[model samples]
Target: MAKLGIPAAPPRGRRIQETITQLRQRILAGEWPVGSRIPTEPQLVEALGVGRNTVREAVRALAHAGVLECRQGSGTYVISTDELAPVVARRLTDDRMAEVIEVRRAFEVEAARLAARRRTPADLAALDDALAAREAAWRGGRVAEFVEADAALHTAVVAAAHNGMLAELYASIGAAMRRTVTQAMGGALTPDRHVDHARLVAAIRAGDPDLAAREAAAFLEPDPGA
Candidate 1:
């Protein structure tokens, strides 16, 4: 990570907490856009006039919150600007998969309903493109590609809802959901899942909220027999 040099004064408060707040403000203010690397530890320490440990603690805090991501042998990069990202990131863990699934269902079900009512032609087009990519990947026996497209489709559906907060929440758990999807794909790739996706998209296109919600729920429902 390369530091742009501290552009502001140290925030007035507890050293570490203030440092964290200031860093977060910088990110939110677009000083560092998403995917942009943050300043290195030494640079941060120098800029903030804080100890090395203070800088480390602030970085760790932000990273855990999902605002910053540290890549081994590389540097930290901004993953998101959502203020809720850190909160959601902290709660999303392996042990909480069930809870995560429930939350995802809540968002997706409502998203489907809203999308049926609110989706524009552009939204439908994006959905179609994503579905086509997913189908092609499945046909090609490309698990990774299928997973990526599947994720993109779900994101498109949520985005079609046109709710900023809902979209942010969905984006917050994106990393976890992608990992889960990849792992599931390691098992058998069932044809019905793709069929379900097509059904959901069709319902949305038809502008049937009830049908769209039902299709979305059915797609998300875990197979009891599995």
Candidate 2:
């Protein structure tokens, strides 16, 4: 267990996050029985070699997401699988397009920010390929091909961020939104969309975070008229 009062430090937050993810996976994998008390923060901190704050954050997130429950002073408990499963399943397929879009907006905004900061030559190449495919599909009036390429382009922007969590979350919901976009905005890629996509790529390549973010948001925002 963790020695008390040690300010937990993480040499690498990604490793710490991975530890936390493993812990969560273990819990969900039935390693922790329902109503079973999981290790305390101090114990987890020591075991995982991460800061107490990291463990606390992970625990709090899980609790908030309904995977775990913490009593005021007692301890954290794994919730029943049936209960937790539904919550996780719902998270995976909630079907709330508005909520999903809100989440995507937040993610894409940060992705644009990171892309401006971290994009590499290879990232630019991948983005170029995706965009080129999208443009070709759009010009050919092949709606399905356009949809696939459009999804690839949007996801390429996320990948350009170089944030693993952001990329993963974006991929998860991007898959869902791919369907939605094909259904909703699959018609004409639109002059506005073409302009916005090109501008976003240019802003990212130019390392302009604000411009890229604005373009991404504009791309996603619904036309009040449409």
Candidate 3:
């Protein structure tokens, strides 16, 4: 029996997994936002109290999962927040925009219906802020800003549903949804394709689930211009 000595080290596989979780947590916590390079190898080793190899393995794992991107000369950068984003994007190719819209209809319509039933005052307040921001972004005519704002408002609706799984699933496929919206708008958003979500919001505010679901589904209908 050994005595007066340090405990045995954890298994190498478990250590590597723990390191990966720690790194992912940092990214999710916004310690290093997307496009920002992460701490260097030595810095991470010191910070995580792990060896150089362990830090390297963790970074490599995240890179494989599309959450981190390591350039040839520059440091590694945070690319995506959700681990499933890249996977979803890859599965939903560009040519499948119709399928993408169908997927959106499934999530958004249900989320809207449930939001009408379950949303709280705070959720309604957040939705109002997001909707206003989305409209302002559209009027500003900055395609990228508008895309993000629109996505934010839809995400707010999903959040209001108060179903953790639905919210998480929406977030998982969020990048793909934004990509389709961007493609549909092409280079710019013409007045002809303007989408007014005021009715959708009003239905939710009034606790009209059927109206909210109808409003959500209506927006996803075939619009040659939209």
TM-score of each: 0.65, 0.55, 0.68
For candidate 1, write residues 8-117 as lDDT tens digits.
Answer: 64443478898898899998787775544688999988887888988899899888777787755447867678767767867788777666677778989999999999
Tens-place lDDT per residue, model 2, 1-226, is: 3468776554566655677687777876767744346988898889877777778878876766566666544468665333433343347454666666667788888898899889999999988888888888888876667776776687788878877556545644543566566656547666544443888899999999998898889856754654
Model 1, poorest ten-residue lDDT window? Answer: 5-14
Q: How are the candidates ranked when ordered by TM-score, highest leading?
A: 3, 1, 2
Query: Which residue pairs show backbone clashes in model 3?
Result: none
CA lDDT scores, all candidates in order: 0.79, 0.70, 0.83
- Whole-model lDDT for model 3 versus the true structure? 0.83
Error of 2 at 137 (Å): 0.9
Ranking by lDDT: 3, 1, 2
Give the distance in Å from residue 80's predicted Cα in candidate 3 to where it truly belongs: 10
Best candidate according to lDDT? 3
- Ten residues in sequence with the least summed lDDT for candidate 2: 80-89
Q: How well does candidate 1 score on lDDT at residue 151?
A: 72
The TM-score between candidate 1 and the true structure equals: 0.65
Supply the global lDDT for candidate 1: 0.79
